[model samples]
Target: MTGHRARRLTAALFATSGYLATIPTANWLTTRYPAAPVAPGVLAPAGVYVVGLTLVMRDVSRELAGRTPVAVAMAGGVALSYWTANETVATASAAAYVLSESLDFAAYEWLRNHGFTIALAISNAVGLIADSILFLSLAFGSLHYLPGQVIGKAWMTGAAVVLLLLRRRAHHSGQLRAPGFSGATPKAVGRPMRRDGGGHDGFGDRAGTPTHPQQNETASEAMP
Candidate 1:
């Protein structure tokens, strides 16, 4: 492979691994430690923090490798949980990941073209809430952790949003060379990239249909 392509793939692999690792790590934390107070009168599993980070990790993987890799990583994460956690925890985590991440994926896609940071935050919000509720209910048969789970995950989500803001500022100020935190604009799932590096729908002029011969060639070159 070309050096550039190889490097991109390597980065994607690392991001995907990070996303998958959080599953077992959260499970381990949950088993090793007891529930703790995350806010006034609100208790949550020790894994709350790690699970919060898990939402961000999935976004990074999706941005780097596209949707397929993220989907695969999610599947792999569920499988890994079975090995790392008890059957109850494994099943709960799997169910939560599938349902919540699906919601996350949709929200992110709908808002991504508007702005990456906004999309990330909003999507994480949806995923975190859904995951927390489902996992807590399924595993513990209660929602005592709901408040703590939301608060803890929000902390991580806020941190991630801030980091993205800094990355964009640095790039714009010429202190960073990458066009995005991922080193490039994220490719839209199942769409050809434009010369301007923006993802678009597969319909209409902005959908990446070449308006000129030069545009046609540029579109081809833009494809990863």
Candidate 2:
């Protein structure tokens, strides 16, 4: 019933829905152009996954006060899988996804803990490049039917831009603020509060003022 609890629930629901949507969206896109060139058709699913992952991870990063590098890596992996239609390519894509995403997660965590924003930015950029290379090499390295490598590279670049921009908007909007810890709360300092129980303030506090001690205590205990 509380504002914070509602925000958390909403965030959780959004994440779950977005994750579930990935499968169907990818499948639909892949099937739409079953006979077309893989590169072009693949872009559909890849674009969707990129947009969804960016929005989801933006909120996650804001809530956690850090970036979710695994999400970005997963975006690359998913794009690769959808692009590659072969069984062997699929397997390789899975492995690449797992490994790259794991590494990205670790790298992001390290950078965050060390207060290295620049390092985090650089690492994320490099990771994106590495993921794209590994994915393309595994999925389409042998294929000559697809257009020049530049096409795929361009797709990757575009996806990265979309993700970064989404992240920036989410951060600026304070959509990533954890439940119960918003501008309306006494503990919140810089962020502005929203009237409808969303935004930086989350839901309206029961008292219609800053959060009370009990609310703060509850929120603190829930921190991960």
Writing each residue's lDDT as its tens digit, candidate 2 over 27-64 gives 34333432233253443223223323432343344333
Local distance difference test values of all predictions, in order = 0.71, 0.43
Flag regions of model 1 displaced more than 4 Å.
Answer: 1-3, 175-224
Model 2 accuracy (lDDT, Cα)? 0.43
lDDT of 2 at 19: 45
Cα lDDT tens digits for candidate 1, 164-184: 677655534341232332233
**What lDDT is reached at residue 140 by model 2?**
52
- The TM-score measured for candidate 1 stands at 0.75
Clashes of each: 0, 3
